[model samples]
Target: MLRVLAVDDEKPLLEELLYLLRSDDRVLSAEGACDATGALRRITRALESGPDGADAIDVVFLDIHMAGLTGLDVARLLAGFAHPPLVVFVTAHEGFAVQAFDLKAVDYVLKPVRPERLAEAVRRASDHLGRSAAQRPPGAAGPPGPPAVPLAGPARHRPAPDTGAAPAAGSAAAAAADRAQDLIAVELGGVTRFVAIADIAYVEAQGDYARLHTDAASHLVRIPLSTLEERWAPRGFVRIHRRHLVALRRIDELRIDAGTTSVRIGAAELQVSRRHARQLRDLLMRQATG
Candidate 1:
């Protein structure tokens, strides 16, 4: 069972969310806050009360665009906590999905919210909490204890974020099957769409987030370009441009004109950066021969 704090400025939606959360068997308690400030206050109070006490919060389902402080700002603030509540962004906007994930969100649920989808987010959150508890040092303080006041080391050391790269693979076939591919999640017509790693034709960088483009559509996710480059290198998704990473298998033809080089994928032609052009040609030749 988990204690959840759901925050949203919209009254009816917030009420409905609380109802759905309360209905879940895994939820021990479901509380609500209209905005970031109130939610932070509740969290501060819970932490001050101590983790072994009654007021602890295990997770927070936050909305992105809020008055006063946005959910991103709130999550950033919470990241500094000694034991912060896990965040799950429940909002209508999909643009901020990548940024939310950068903040280490448990899950991103788009609106209009569905019972089943929210349930999935809760399950993920529960699993995260369990893993965290399992990894804690022996006899360390229990979960969800925050300082009511500022700590001496407010900037507590955080562990490293996982590199999206796959492990050493023996063969291409086995590698694809064993790769640690995260099915990029997207919301389409109120339904969640899962984009498989293999289906991606290419990736385009959008600042902090990366966009996954397939034959039919493109989906944005909260992963950096550099991270994807390292992670997908084993899978042959090569960096052609700073803003572009194309699947080597998807390349149709290589073009060079006026000393400029590019690769054609279907009808799209992406320029190959001067530094990477030679590497791309060599890899393509090796792939063709071997």
Candidate 2:
């Protein structure tokens, strides 16, 4: 679990960001500051209390454009600290990405924040924390520290290393979130493999776990079915039934027989619940016509 601070001058955006961060099981706590000054004050308090303290912030989701001191300024000031909270710049503009990286920001997120995008940022932050935690000597002193050096320049685009510290609970849906949002991590036999998101045809819920089905086989992961639904919604995975989530692009045909709704993906036919029938049909129709 990680402690997070979200800074955005817009009240609605700040509230929404806070809600999303707090909703994540990965987060220990989430707080907000409307501007750079307030964010700095809160950060100062947390730092003064010590890094291991209850109020310590592990990551800061900052808006790049602000009235007085911008998020970039804060990041620069943070770099001067012997220990600094990780910075993730949020902006509507793509122009500042280079500058943000130059300031050592771990991730850069664009405006009208998407849940999956923010989730990816959180995963990177978690990996940094995990890797740092693993490197620290046992029972060694002062607060769980930030990365010795932040990921910046082209290095920021590189995938995170396996921290080997019992990783994030997201399955195929979130595994892709670990880095580039293109591949999902799955453990098969005794070895872990990265599965392409484009290869997953559907996901089936099995108790507390989800099984990712591809062309050849299935892989089970510990993450919940609901978690995958939320994160993969943007990727075209939709709830066809309470027990099934199918990829829109993978659907071979939609079938309707005597008021029953079902979909065919390859040779497998899965029933679509009445509640999700309309939405699934709408999405599929759009996928077809658009």
Q: Name the runs in model 1 displaced over 4 angstroms.
A: 142-290
- By TM-score, who's the top model here? 1
lDDT by residue for model 1 over 74-111, one digit each (tens)?
78778776778789999999999999999999999999
Tell me how far candidate 1 lies from the true structure as C-alpha RMSD in angstroms: 20.9
Candidate 2 local Cα displacement, residue 152, angstroms:
31
* Each prediction's whole-model lDDT (CA): 0.80, 0.80
Estimate candidate 1's alpha-carbon lDDT, on a 0 to 1 scale.
Answer: 0.80
| Colliding residue pairs in candidate 2 | none
Candidate 2 residues lying further than 4 Å off, grouped into runs, are 143-290
Over the stretch 1-290, how does candidate 2's per-residue lDDT look in tens digits? Answer: 99999999899999999998988889999999987657876787677666787768889999987644468867876776666789999899999999999988889999889999999999999999899889989876475333222111111146669877875566654765554687778888899898877788999999999999988989998889899999898887888998999887777656667778887787789999999988876664344222
Residue 201 of model 2 has an lDDT of 91
